[model samples]
Target: MRSQLRPETRIDRCFEALKREGRPAFVTFVTAGDPDYETSKAILLGLPEAGADVIEIGMPFSDPMADGPAVQASSLRALKAGQTMKRTLQLVREFRAKDNLTPIVLMGYYNPIYVYPSEAFLDEARDAGIDGMIIVDVPPEADEELCLPAIQRGLSFIRLATPTTDDKRLPAVLANTSGFVYYVSITGITGAAAPVVSDVRAQVARIKRSTPLPVVVGFGVRTPEQARVIADCADGVVVGSALVETIRTTLGTDGRAGPDTVSAVHRIVHNLAAGLRGAAARV
Candidate 1:
């Protein structure tokens, strides 16, 4: 049964829809205003049609500690291109203009939101049609500061459950986590190494036992086959670094988005989505 403690959100609706289709959600992440605003906006607008079930827009910050090299570089590009918190919210608003069904979750550190003054940022984010948030730096113990407040404002405060999150520590992680539980498939930062499918299966099962929320595995996933294997065991698959790398590869010599940037990224997403759909068909 779905948890009744929190209100039904777009993120909830997305997973429910995927459940009905018997497939795992294909979640994609990209840095807002990477390269530039227009190019980033174009990529955001095309994701849903390209097979992305949920979109995570990285709120560009100077020091993104939790990210790997690819994601960290993407953030730097966005910041160098003048991406700000306001611009990030603007990207969401533009995406909302065309896509109301797809869930948009802002993923980043706490410093930006903290300097945005937190409360005002939440109000603006909600108004801009953001569905949830994955603030990597904030913990459950600091719920009073942001997590609880975000939940109060109808935004799902998603939490990350690492491989090291044992049974004793699981409850606290799930206590305030809504939307879904993001199971970090590996220990280190995003895009470290390929996770062993059997290990991922065990950890995802462990997380499921503790929470009613859907469990989505991420971090080491890079290819369509990997997405398929991971989705076979988890409720969803999140691929970030791979897609960001696609953007990097397709850029022009001067580092701006080339003609193939949008299409290349979409191509990867389409293939990943196909992989997840194939997993569903096998079931």
Candidate 2:
């Protein structure tokens, strides 16, 4: 467990605490049951060891609109194979038995949560050793009902902002954003390429001007150089599609993350970790 004694601190506090200690956090995202439960567990546990400072465990749902083809495909694969919210929480419990301290954040759409009762979902998440929840589709207008309770439960409720979000609306999003505000680097879905680097930097700057919360840039970041570039403007960079794509290619037509999959992800994370460290040095 973290020794700083802010168990109730929002997700941003966790990242801020780490930043004060002079280390950039590595956040990795993976579907709960793309390959299977055991594989999901492996990815979760392996992440911290593989240089991930935080783990974003994806709760698979049928309609993941925020996700691009890579993540959408992964979600479909997991759903087709029968992954549910309950099973995902169970995986968190299993992960906690061995590794107790690393922060685990659940990322997914709101449909699954809507299917289950909200308070019940929060209770289960707390019991499962989850530190936070990222319901991608939940808007700030619904914060009174959703984000507030999550904060009260001592679980961080992270929010997302896209390129289209305006100045007046950005603060509202930041106000409800607990962990770190997930600033989508581009205007489109998760895997689409960011056409201009300057635009992303400007967006990060705009968000930073309005809030003190640490901003983590994500979506369409596919390489170490890209991660490094994005990190220059934000506190953290999140890469999803690229990593998931690695998993897909490693698996043959018959769903399996072969030997190459693990090795590829390991290498990619290792390099990204190094790049983030380098970025931290510049700051």
Candidate 3:
């Protein structure tokens, strides 16, 4: 019998498509209105054209504890600029208008989603063409009531598995996780510190044995070498804090990443993408 596709099938398809083309998918993240709406929009639009396989649009929230200081600061800037969940969805709608193929995953803490009825949030997400969601704070036990509806509505619930996730609990996490599994490479929050553990590859291998899902490693992955190292064992690499830091440095007090921002972003993403592509090229 043919197996049913995951709820967020587009994301799975994108991963497979990139693999077929001999490239480890590059998933880039940016806050929805980081510096301002227009620059955020430009980066989102430019990503796929510039070689990004998937885009994670961060929905800024008041308390982003899971994120490091840089992402928290970015979200604060977006909030101060009057960015709301409504505006973030509008960004997704605007993106869908031009590019419908590249999967877009909305990543953020759970408070904003909790503010809205789950059904309303899922419906709006579907209308805006969001392919998946990564609610950093929601564990699988709580997701049935809080997130399953989105799965029922054709959106992937991407779960985050930490180094602390053991064999007994890992299956439960993967059982509910759809699209692709997000394997946290470190023990704590997102940033450029060296990983807390030395056996991430072993952790990834253990997770892969439990399910047939594509595993994407994230957190503490800042440079091309780090990306290449993770890409060697995982399906993709997620880079957020590092890129956000670059944008933060580029932006002056005026809430803009300055004139040279595009060049800087392109340079960083290009290097990350190249590293991801290296392993695929050899395949």
Candidate 4:
């Protein structure tokens, strides 16, 4: 239904192709300019080849309240390396020059976009080959300010449904939500701990009964086995903090990204993709 009216975007195309393939998508996330731009770009360009169906490019902000320690540190590293809203979008632009098929979603806080002029930012993002967004601080109540405008420009405004989103509040959360709904399986911040498989399965079932949009479970998923379990229960599985932690491990003594930074992330994504692929085959 959301796809019928909006311009055909890479996000929609990617999900549709997965439906035909009878497999769940493996979504990946990384901070732009973490340590430096070139290294982050290498990770970005390498993800899809490593089997990432959708990539969430985080825009580095000075104050990230919703992020966990790992993600917060990554944001600080990116900002220290000069990652701005302009630079983040520019990274997507550079990525689009070579690969235009995999969907890229901008995920972060709202302050940067609001400071950049909402309409102007949307125009530039639409031109930059961005497919969707997940602004954590901006809720459905503020749709007029950013959400609606983004949808009008054909950008999918992905909403987050957490463990606290009850049946009463679920409708409001799903109302303006486009693309796919991100179901945070855990209650706390990112990189905390793995969620119970049965609880997440029940929540995914509940959300699916309410909305036609795909329900992707994320947060606290740190292993290939965990990804496979979540993929079996939900429409997709998103792995972020664990992946960012890998980047952290690859940093040198000076905190600069080492030569193996990109390769480290590639291995994680490769194993996760293989896990989901195997799960899909079993189904």
Angstrom error at residue 262, model 1: 0.6
- Decreasing TM-score order of the candidates: 1, 4, 3, 2
Model 2 steric clash pairs: 11-179, 12-179
TM-score of each: 0.98, 0.91, 0.95, 0.97
Cα error, candidate 3, residue 27 (Å): 0.9
Per-residue accuracy of model 3 over 1-283 as CA lDDT, tens digit each? 1126543377988987877876777889889987778788887888887778899999999999888898999899889888999999999999999998999999998878878766788899988999889998888888777668878888888999988999989978987677889999888888847663348789888999987878898998888888877788788889998878888888877866688666677678988888777767766
The residue ranges of model 3 lying beyond 4 angstroms of the native Cα positions read 1-8, 196-198
Q: What TM value does model 1 have?
A: 0.98
lDDT of each: 0.93, 0.79, 0.84, 0.92
Query: Which model is ahead, 2 or 3, in terms of lDDT?
Result: 3
Q: Please say which candidate is ahead in lDDT: 3 or 4.
A: 4
Best model per lDDT: 1
lDDT per residue for candidate 4 within 1-283, as digits (tens), equals 6556766677777888999999999999899999699999999999999999999988998888888999999999999998889999899999999999999899998989998988999999999999899999998888899999998888899999999999999999999888899999999888787899999999999999999888898989889899998899998999999888999999999999998999999999999999999989999
Q: Per-prediction RMSD in angstroms?
A: 1.1, 3.1, 1.8, 1.0
RMSD of 1: 1.1
* Superior by TM-score: candidate 1 or candidate 2: 1
* Model 2 per-residue lDDT at 138: 83
Q: Candidate 1, residue 42: CA error in Å?
A: 0.5
Best by TM-score: 1
